[model samples]
Target: MTDLKHLFFSLGLEQLDLSEKEKNIINAFIEQSTPRFNDICHQRQDKEPLALLLGYMTQQHHIASSRWIEQQTAYHQMQSVFQSSVGTEHASKFINQDVDEYILITLLWLLVQGANKIDYSYANEQAETLLAHIHEETKESNDSKEDEQLRQRLMQAFYQGKKTTQQSLFTKLKRMFRLTQQQ
Candidate 1:
C-alpha cells in the first residue's frame, strides 16, 4: 500500500481503494484548494491543506455513521485522531468557517458522484442536505464562482468517464519533502 493509504488505514479512516482517476481528481482538488486556502489564511503550512480536507471528510463519514446524539462525540474523536496523526497545527485549522464550507461543498459533490469508497449508504441524503445548506448560505455571495467552475470541471470529468494516470504516493511525499527542504 502507498504511504497515504497506510496512513489512512492506521487512523481507521476508509480504505484508499480509489482508482487512478479518482486519486487524480482528489489531488486536483487539493491543488486547487491550496492556493485559495493560502490566499485566505495568509500562512502556508505544507500539509495543512490536505489534512484539513481529509480530516473534515473523515469527520463527516464518522458523523454519518453515528447516531445524531453521538455525532458531537464522533466529531471530536475524529478531530483528535487527525490532530494526533497529522499534528495539531495542521488539524486545528479544519474548523475555519470558510474552509469548512469549501470542503463540505466539494466533498458533497464527490459523494454525489457515487463512484468511490467514500460513499456510505446514506451518503446521497447527506450530500443533498449539505449541498442545500451550502446553497442557502451562499445565496447572496458571489465568491462561489471559482468553486462552481471547479465543480463543473469535476462533473465533466466524471460524466466523460475520463481516467488520469497517477503517481505513487510515496514518490509524491518524497518530492514534497524535498521541495520543502529546498525552500
Candidate 2:
C-alpha cells in the first residue's frame, strides 16, 4: 500500500483512530440509534409549543437582560471552543455540555419565567412537572447544591413576580456555578 493508505491502515488499529470504513460503520450505527424524525420533535408546531413553554420561563424567572447578555457572551465563547473541539453540527453529539453559561442561565430563565406563570405552591410540583415535559434523551447535569439552590431562589423570585438587583443574582449564580471572575 501507499504511504497515505498505510497511515490510514495504521490508524485503524488504534482504539482512538478509525479507517474510513470503520468511521462509516460507526456513523451508520449512530443514525440507527435515534428514533425516526416523525417520532421525534420534528414538527414545527410541536417545537413552537415547547418554545412557548420556555418563553414563559424566560418571561417569569429570567434575571435582567444585562446578565443574560453576559451569560450569552460566556455561552458563545464556550460554544466556539466546543465547535473547535468537535465541529459545529457534531458538537452536541460528541460533547454536549450546557454549551456555556447561557444554556444554564437560559434554563434558569425559563424555570423562573415558566414557574412564575403558575402559583408558588406548585414550585416543586412545577419542577417535577417541567421534568416530565422534556425528552428522556436530555442528560441531567451534575451541578453543586449551592448553585442549584441559588438558581431555585431566583426562580422563586421570578415566580413571585420580582426582579432583584443584577449584582446580587449574578453573584449567587456565579458562585454556585463556580464561574471565574475572568469569565
Best by lDDT: 1
User: In lDDT terms, how accurate is model 2?
Assistant: 0.40
C-alpha lDDT values of all predictions: 0.44, 0.40
10 residues in a row with least lDDT, candidate 1? 158-167
Model 2: ten consecutive residues of lowest lDDT: 4-13
Steric overlap count per candidate: 0, 7
Off by over 4 Å in 2: 1-94, 97-117, 129-135, 139-160, 163-183
TM-score of each: 0.26, 0.23
Model 1, span 1-183: residue lDDT tens: 543333333332233234565555555544544554445334545554334444544554445333332344555677678889999888866552343434433453343233333334344455444444444543324456654654454343332211111224456888999999999
